[model samples]
Target: MKIIVTYDVKQILTEESRASYLDEWQKEHASLLRECDHLQFEMKRLQKKRPSDQKWIADQFDKEIRTRSERMSFLDFKMDQLDQLTLGAEIHDGEIQSIQEVQMGDEWHGREQKGKIVVKDGIVQSIVPDSKGKDIMI
Candidate 1:
């Protein structure tokens, strides 16, 4: 059986791209968090003031608070996506290394008894024995 080796070059590149994305995300997240904290402090200070003195101010504060909340949520989602991409990249890199080692035609007889090779998500899944004399799987 002919084994199909799957490697997602796009995914690898996308994964590598996450470092920059993550850095930007982190900076934005920190800024948002700081803004939220400042907003909360201001809100508290406003709450202590005379309501009649700051008429209609609550609406503006509410809008700013909501906008900050939405920004935080979006940043959280972006961070999650970045984390997943980073993890996928690491897994794929490991798989690529494994495939390279296996394909190097090393002395498998003495080093490793027998193993089957399976590739998934741009990496090797497993290596099993071919008891029935079948073709090697990549």
Candidate 2:
């Protein structure tokens, strides 16, 4: 039988990758800001068009706008942390999923532990096991 597993991906910060990350983050931040502006404009227009339901409409728009605002703040925090990372430092990139085969009495964690995958310059570098001497069944 086979089972799907998820593993962590670690990225080694370099000048090239750092710049790329910054650019991507900045673009996302700008997009979210623009979305908020558009939503605010729509909220105003709706309120003016329907004064009787103005409060309800405004509340609905505020909820969505609040969600986006929170996300933007989180992005800013991430960008700041990225800026503070030293070159060559490993950072948690994301995760990857893989399928593995297993049999009866198989030690799942020992044999197929979801370890860390190291990357540099957008390329895979190495895979590290969580336990020493335990090989990852990649």
Candidate 3:
């Protein structure tokens, strides 16, 4: 039998990764800013044509603008955080799923071992504690 297991992916930050992240975030920020500007322009044009619906239209636009503003703030914080990360520091990238073989009587769950993948410079550095997930028999 085989079962699926989840393992954490960790990245060893380097100058290359940092620059990549900053560049990506900058592009996203610019796109978001452009969207906000377009929304503002549309809102103004709509309110000018329909004075009676101005308040409702403004409220809807304001809601969307506020949401984007909050996201931009968060992106700023993320960019700042990325800038502060030191080279060779490990950070959690995300998770991946793996398949593991198991026997009928095997205790396949509740193991207290680290299932992790360490990567550096876009290459797999190591599979921690082996693919069996660092488990031990009691």
lDDT of 3: 0.83
lDDT ranking of the models = 2, 3, 1
The count of residue-pair clashes in candidate 1 stands at 3
What tens digits encode model 3's per-residue C-alpha lDDT throughout 5-69? 67788888999888877898899999889999999999999999999999999999999999998
RMSD of each: 13.8, 2.6, 4.3
Candidate 1: where are CA atoms >4 Å away?
A: 1-16, 53-55, 86-138
After superposing candidate 3 on the true structure, give the runs of residues whose Cα lies further than 4 Å from its correct spot: 107-114, 129-138
Candidate whose TM-score is highest: 2
- Give me candidate 2's TM-score against the actual structure: 0.87
The models' CA-based lDDT, in order, is 0.56, 0.85, 0.83
Candidate 2 lDDT over residue span 1-138, tens digit each: 987766789888999999988899889989999999999999999999999999999999999999999989998998999989899999888998877777898765554556678888978888765444343433
Per candidate, the number of residue pairs that clash is 3, 0, 0
lDDT of 1 by residue, 1-138 (tens): 223333322233244456656787789888988887888788768867856745466677778978988998998896786676534352222322123234454434523333234444445444444323343444
Residue 71 error, candidate 3, Å: 1.3
Candidate 2 colliding pairs? none
